[model samples]
Target chain A: MKDLVPERYALAFRLYPYARSPDQDATAPVRHKAIVVGGGPIGLATALDLGRRGVPVVLLDDHEGAGLGSRALCFAKRTLEICDRLGAAAPMLDKGVQWNLGKVFHDDRLLYEFNLLPEGGHAMPAFINLQQPWFEKFLHDAITAAQAEGAPIELRGRNRVDAVIPAADHVTLEVMTPDGPYRIEADWLIACDGARSPLRNMLGLGFDGRVFEDNFLIADVKMKADFPTERWFWFEPHFKSGDSALLHKQPDDIWRIDFQLGWNIDRAKELEPARIRARVDAMLGPDVDYELDWCSIYTFQCRRMAQFRHGRVLFAGDAAHQVSPFGARGANSGVQDADNLGWKLALVVQGIAPDSLLDSYDAERVHGADENILNSTRATDFITPKTPVSKMFRNAVLTLAETLPFARTIVNSGRLSVPCTYDRSALNGPDHPEMPARTRPGSPCPDAPVGQGWLLSHLGQGFILLTIGLDAPESVMAHGLTVPRLALEATPELAARYLGGAKGAVYLIRPDQHVAARWDHYDADAVAAATARAIGKE
Target chain B: MLITTPNLTRPDESYARLIATHEGLDEAGSHALNARLILILMNHIGDDAVLAEAMRLARETGTEAA
Candidate 1:
């Protein structure tokens, strides 16, 4: 307890340390193409996505690197896929503990076990349990490599944004560093400053949502034990540790344990090492020796801004929305927000796409935020049943889940994060009704083994004309933009995922690998119109 | 789904069994038993439309009788 330095400063690695930029010494405020505030997972990923697209972007953070503690442990398949696009998923998958099986328990009996990915042909697993620090570290490492390859990215540490002024076209910012305060401007401002977003507050925006009346003690413990890398959850645990408990294995030998420490607990007393160890002792028995790596008491709120985009400024990640940690939706959804916004912002900045394309970012990400909020809230309600009837129903569901397959579906031990399909998005183009719904308009392109590589690997960050069992021109010109064709023979996995009853389909995929439109065969006029609608030109 | 007329041929036997299930239970125990019974019955009546009708009828009849 004596060494109380923040985890960001105490990590084994030092990221972008505070350094004076040329903008700091300029005579007047320097205006940049894109300025991202906060160097968290969402911020860094956003900058990386934009930078890789040849957009000059700067990321400003108050800290040098990720703070201490294994904050977010579960990165879903969709998150890994997004990271794959950013050239960061390799290290994450290499270092992360991948698991698709999860076990749910009631009292001392096992209720049921479920596998997230039963039929798998995808490149990434169902989920990976990597500590948040490592997740951000991988993104930073990728940024470093991308910079070496001449991707226009500049990371500034210990630079806190003091103020932001938004006008019709650009945004003005006052940044404070260790040396002093300086003024800068950005054509577009992105706020990824986490849950308690100071930037959101500065802009006088309201992040309105419900806060559950409960507390959770998250303890990351390091031990030499042979626990399988699977997620184990308990309701009314037999050990009497708490109301509910969760155990997961991370990359290192460290295991994460979360105990639901009901509302109205002593903040200082509960944090005592002996008190926390008592709960751990009860769970692990007397023989297993373990050391507490880090622990914290967190009370979560399922919240989001009214709208993600406000004029010239955009909010992303926890700055735009927040959810309970039960479903691991927090960081996963944030990275998706970066994925959704990057291409649109890039096109808009390059003058290829109209400004209305950015509005779809607000429309689509707000949709994503709502979906995450709904799922996490439902999971929270089931975890902490407020009323006696709710508790009884929860127990009843658990009771029946032990033997009945139907009852098992009722049990909600966190729905877990899944990619959201913008079913009703304004940017969505025409959908082939005969095609599989999984790869319809507004859905993320399902990855399937293509040739030696994967389907998603070929949908390189641009408008793609993906043709299956058909021939198309090398590229089609649409609204002064080129849509290259990636031809492939219809494999069984691809047929099942992309082309259902339809024969020889042509798909118009957005830059973020989302299906915009599909047809039985290529028609240059139809593809061009769909491309126009996909980018909000319609 | 909510049979206004008698559907169970052995209605008395069924009522007797229901009463016997709560014989030795205290107030809270009886309440818990009733909850379990409701869930079991809900599972038996798998159709959501039928269950909704029964639920609505129960609410309507309870308010009228009270």
Candidate 2:
């Protein structure tokens, strides 16, 4: 019998002694402005955002280092932009495989290939495939640097939360450390703990959704190959008797392969080294040299908590929701949740915005989670039909998609993750006439080349006014508003895209680079009202 | 310009009734029922040109799986 391959991702685990160990003389619990649990991508990103905003934060994680394997290998463009804002995108872009094209196959025949981003004006590409461990390591390094720079971010590893007590104004936590147990208090708690969140369990929250019966075997293998860096998905491939298979390339010559195993297959038997070797040997020619890096089996699920916010404790990432891995929505949506929550929490902590502003976080992210769940459920249902008629329709769609353009719309393997627009958000202000629909009130600001850099590089991290074809008002700064105004040169491309021949157009953009409002003329009172609405004061 | 703009007033109730019609049938039986319903609805419409236009509109506004 062949020996099973051991997991090979190397993560350096560092242990830190408990800083606030209990003493003989009783002392007041150390208070933090914000306490973030779970040091994964979402937690680290939230910590970085809060620290950059000068909000003191304490981050806790039970584990000492990165996760075991390359769990989430795809980072969407919006997520990379969020990471870029937090100062961690350069390492990811340098070490990740950037791919924007994908091919889908039905058995031996090729169905179609798609290009996610056909236009290339944006700074970030449509997608990058980097191992989850490397992504976390980059985030960790950023947090360390921020701490050194007096950002007041204390990352505590090997500290587990044993109890959670919520109050009207604060949340108390009982943390277990390497030395002993200690208690901590915080004005707000952000839970980024993963799918099986201990904090969520202690709070008695339940996820309300469906659990799929199908199981997928994921194997990461390292090999030197010349295959192009594009996603390849097969339905009932010739080498495997399963319903589906997926192949994706990651950084460092590692490739992720997923094979569908129907509901009743013995998972233990399927994971054996000999059986996995046979499967790999049949799929790739038997002569290829490869080494298994990691292997695991997972059942797909589409579930989420009814609400992500509970008083002072807010949940982000997999702790708040879980989706099937097909669409890459799990970690991507979590990062977006962090991005949305970070700015709002910072403002509230600094007393610049009221706590009611956090309600929009729940509303917007609930909408985002529902969107992810809906897409994930549809993709899973298409991939694994429950009824015979459903299966017939799915097959018919795939077969017809080969020649018919309309039928191609129904062929869904996975929709892939895209940023969600909060159009119905209550914080959105009035829209102006003749402006482009793409940059509507709740939409993220579209990136354009401004001189030598992208437009988004100049916008986010604070409220700003973008004026096109107009001069800034002389009294605009005296309105007691803290917004910085930028006047564009009305270049032909900018005017055509944003102004649409309407001169003197003004736009109010939020700290997260989402459009708050736009007007053909600037009114200081109106701008202040719009800014107030954007911060959830109205 | 838009003819088929939410004609059904009580869509949720109508949907429940429509699904209830196929409660106990097998795959082929359910498909036959669907065919029969389509024929009945087509006859109710009664105009051949309108039916053709409806078919074209339905085919044109293809369902996005996402």
Residue-wise lDDT of candidate 2 within A1-538, one digit each (tens)?
4322222334444423335444212376677899999888899889888998899988888766686788888999889888887778999999999998898889888888887863556778889999888899998788777778888787776678899999999999988765666788999999999998999999999987899999998888899978788999988788873689898999889999888988999889999988887887777777789999899989978999999999999999999999999899999999999988988998899887889989999999999999999999999999998887677667766766676555566678899998888888988988977888878888877777788887788887688888986776632442234788877877655676678747768898887778888999888878888888888788
What is the per-residue lDDT of model 1 for residues A1-538, given as tens digits with 9 covering 90 to 100?
3322133446544689888999989999999999999888999999999999999999999888887778888999999999999999999999999898899999999999988864567899889999988999999999999999999999998888888889898999988887788999999999999998998999899999999999999988999988887899999999988899998998779999999999999978999999999999999899999999999999999999998999889999999999999888999999999999999999999999998888899889889989889999999999999899899888878888898888888799898888989898887778887889889899999999987888899875799999999999999999979999998989999899888998889999998999988999889999999999988899
The estimated TM-scores of all candidates read 0.96, 0.87
> What DockQ, on C-alphas, does every prediction get?
0.53, 0.06
Best by TM-score: 1
Q: Global lDDT of each model?
A: 0.90, 0.83
**Proportion of native contacts found in each model?**
0.38, 0.00
> Which 10 consecutive positions of candidate 1 chain A have the poorest summed lDDT?
A1-10
Error of 1 at A342 (Å): 0.2
What share of the reference contacts is kept in model 1? 0.38
Worst lDDT 10-window in candidate 2 chain B: B35-44
- Comparing only chain A of model 1 with the true chain A, what is the TM-score? 0.98
